[model samples]
Target: MDKKQAQALGKLLRLSREKAGLSGRELADRSGMAASNVLRLEQGTIANPRPETLKSLADVLDLDLSDLYAAAGYIQPEGLPSFAPYLRSKYSGLPASAQRELETSFAKIAAKHGYDPNGPQPGEDETE
Candidate 1:
């Protein structure tokens, strides 16, 4: 996978870990991986984690291997070309806080285009 995909996966993994209330060191210990390795994984520095390592990480994180693989942008051996649509739909079902974070991220993006959080910018057309 490309760097962008790796980065996106890393962000998702980090968020999952946080939501699960596990520190990097704790996850590392549970997975029998080095703490630094776990940190690296969360930082997208380890783009291609080994299958065994992935499995171990998934086990500790209480995640299905398929979900982890999908997060990492890997196509299942016998399935679709992309799991993004599935992942997106699943992510949409997360808790309110998670949804708020997603909304905030989009708000930041919109802000860059001169749109205010409350409404349109001055002189901006209401309908495009």
Candidate 2:
């Protein structure tokens, strides 16, 4: 993934860890990783964490592997396919404004369902 994607994923993972009441050091202890490594992962300095490392993290954080991948933009969700695929299937020839409308609609739906496309909920603690 690109640097931006990696950064986004790292942010998401950090949020998830905090929401689950885990501190970076605590997560490291549970996952058998170094605290510095955890910090680097959360900071996107380590863009490509090993699959086994991710698995260990998921196990400690109680997250599904697919969910983690989706957060990283590595894989799309099952029900709501990737935006690229969706656009190609339904509005490949549409104007930019139409695409904007589609994105807006999807954003509304996601927000209504308590999913924040911007990131995790506000006022969330970064360190648990």
Candidate 3:
């Protein structure tokens, strides 16, 4: 990862950890990784960490592996996420009320665009 991406990844990791109420050392212990490695990741010293390492961190932090992978730039960016989810992922500091408001507004816009929230999910197996 480039310097800027590394920095952003580190910040995202750190913020996610803090949001989950885990200290770096606690995360290390829970993830069964060395404290220094966790510190290095949060400090942006490690580039291109192994998938298992990211999985461990994600598990310990209660994050979806895909979300962690996306933040780590492992996945190709897709279409825009709904506003509430995008904000929650990138800005964990947002207050709950504000997030709910954005979700409500985004739901309205999506409905106007004919996106049915209750319909079969994208790529879902309809034959099941």
Query: Which residue pairs clash within candidate 2?
Result: none
Q: Each candidate's TM vs. the true structure? A: 0.57, 0.54, 0.57
Residues 60-95, model 3: lDDT tens digits: 887888876776778655665656678676656788
Off by over 4 Å in 1: 79-128
Q: Which stretches of candidate 3 lie over 4 Å from their true place?
A: 76-128
How far residue 45's Cα lies from its native spot in candidate 1, in Å, is: 1.1
**Least accurate 10 contiguous residues by lDDT in model 3:** 75-84
Which 10 residues in a row give candidate 1 its minimum summed lDDT? 79-88
Candidate achieving higher TM-score, 1 or 2: 1
Clashes of each: 0, 0, 0
Q: Write the per-residue lDDT of candidate 1 for residues 2-62, one digit (tens) a residue.
A: 6776777678778878988999998889889999998888888888877788888887877
Cα RMSD to the true fold for all candidates: 12.7, 15.7, 10.6
